[model samples]
Target chain A: MEDPMPFGTALHDRVRDEHPDLDHLVRVATRSGTRIRRRRHAIATAVTASGVAAVAIGVAMLGGSDLRSGGEPDVAVQPTAPASHPVDQPPRTRAERAHARALRALQDAPVYVDSPDWRCDQPLDEKFICTHGAASVVVVWRPAETWADYQDPAKAGPETFISDVHGQFFATVNAGPDTTHAQVVEVGEALIWAE
Target chain B: MITDAGKDSEDFGDFVRATGTQLYRQALLLTGDHHLAEDLTQTTYAKVYASWRRVSRADNPVAYARTTLLNSFFSHRRLRRSGELPTDPTLGRESSAPEDDPETRLDLLAALTILPPRDRAVLVLRYWEDRSVADTARDLGMTETGVRTRSRRALQRLRPLLGAELTERTM
Candidate 1:
């Protein structure tokens, strides 16, 4: 302690001359901080992706619930339209009554769903489109082309079924995931043409 | 990949390489415990590295790192020594080396332990770091007058402890 300088200088000299384990400490600190930052960035990305997925699911659900009500078809079967066939002869065949019943069911069917489902649409003037849940049935008033079962590529479901009901009417049932083959046929058979 | 983040990390590592020794010495003066000083120095660098983008953009990154170390010391001053004293096993090895006045070193550490953390910080910045009254004030977030007063009072407190230690050594 000879010529012990002022306490401050002595203190500074004591620290300034000292050495510590620098390599290990600096390496650990830098690595730990960078790892934590990368973890936070990954978590943020995952949260953003999940948020987008949730919004898409919400929009899809809202679309289905939007048009769930049972309402009249876009085109009603006009009773006064010019008949293409003789009107006085009553259809006495068993198949004739079934076709008329199917047309009646079409007039009683509900409102339309949106693009995600088998959305009900009419491509012809005399055709009336109606929906039941995810399933749809299109009724043609006069003799028209018997359309075939067509797959809607965008949706995951069974193919649609189109069949001429009697001699003068065509019934097309769009089969959705919720509807089976027999269920779609039943939907086609639901149409009626009662006076 | 040399992305912005990668560059920031590289720059931070370089900064640590340049300033780590000086900062560790400053921590040693502040805490008077080799292992504790090492811990404090590592923690300070880690905080700076975490916000490397902002820290690198600062006018004086060394000053920024010093402030963070001081703040951490003030907040967690009683950081447990894991049931140990201010001295550590490493200093025993350090004391045997040449120019190691073990008794004088012990006296300094014992003297520092008498004062509270704020007074210790004032002494460290003023004496060890050779910071001006104004610079010490900014580092400790105190007024210049407060730095002067604390430095005066802290020295007044340390005098007798050091005197007693020297007398004990002479006997």
Candidate 2:
């Protein structure tokens, strides 16, 4: 059999010659038109306004999880390390406390994940905002000993909660009924669902 | 972030008018079907609109647009779960009949259909646009040698479909 023709300028010309309305195609592809843009802008504006109002009211109700329930325990930042001694010192700032909590959480958390699947497939239920059917690892934090050594039953965070969709990082923040707490999670490439 | 409406539209319009035809041809070759080509083109523009501020400032806006289009194509493929895109009119319009040899045109389209999207793009960029191997390499992010290799392989695959006469006459 004769060898297949090599694709080069000749082939390009042939395709071009056959299809003359090529510009229109690109135009059609890239042109979302003004209406779509306007709609997108309106939606974004509304969302921003709502977000501002939420901040003003000192409460942000993100989709999923009912943070307004009365029985919910207060979510507080955990300490970086287990207390060694009663060394009298200035109380840590909120930012300092959150950072220390993140560092300690990373260092001392005990998770029994052997594979990526085990890590990602941890159950998330109606009470906990997590993957219902999807797989994800869970990271839980215990509150500081001085305040109350409690893991708020209503609060859960996935310190390694990588999305199995857009690969965007999402740290769960459980701030009780009125305050906000967050977990720093890393977004991994596989979370993009390349497969 | 200068977001002047009139200035942006005019600049985007000029860019579209200048590069639209070339992009269409490239899209047509990549998808083989006209409607899919149009859909690809339109999506490309929407993306350009979304990032027009940064894109307009870049020295190689065309390159940015092309990459955007390619990424869009790949993304659609992932969503659709198949590389075999539809030729439905809802996607894009039918190709216009050109005053050329029908057999040659058919042969070319047939040959293009057999090649992978990237290979088709390489040929379109190389020949129709009259770009150097280096320029094609730069645009497609392939090494010069890789471009040459793909080009050779693409031609070799197209030769049999085009037949001996077409190859000799065209080459």
**In terms of TM-score, how similar is model 1 to the real structure?**
0.50
Window of ten residues with lowest summed lDDT in model 2 chain A: A123-132
Could you list the CA RMSD of all candidates, in the order they appear? 30.0, 19.0
Query: In candidate 1, which residue ranges exceed 4 Å CA deviation?
Result: A1-5, A39-195, B1-6, B81-100, B164-171
Residues A11-129 of candidate 1 have per-residue lDDT tens digits of 75566567766677668778656644564565465456555555554554555455365443332222221233212233466556444334423332221112222323322234444
lDDT of 2 by residue, A106-165 (tens): 222221122222122111110112221222223322223312212343333322332222
Model 1: reference contacts kept, as a fraction: 0.40
Q: Taking the candidates in order, what DockQ does each have?
A: 0.15, 0.15
| lDDT, model 1, position A111 | 18
Interface RMSD of each: 19.5, 10.9
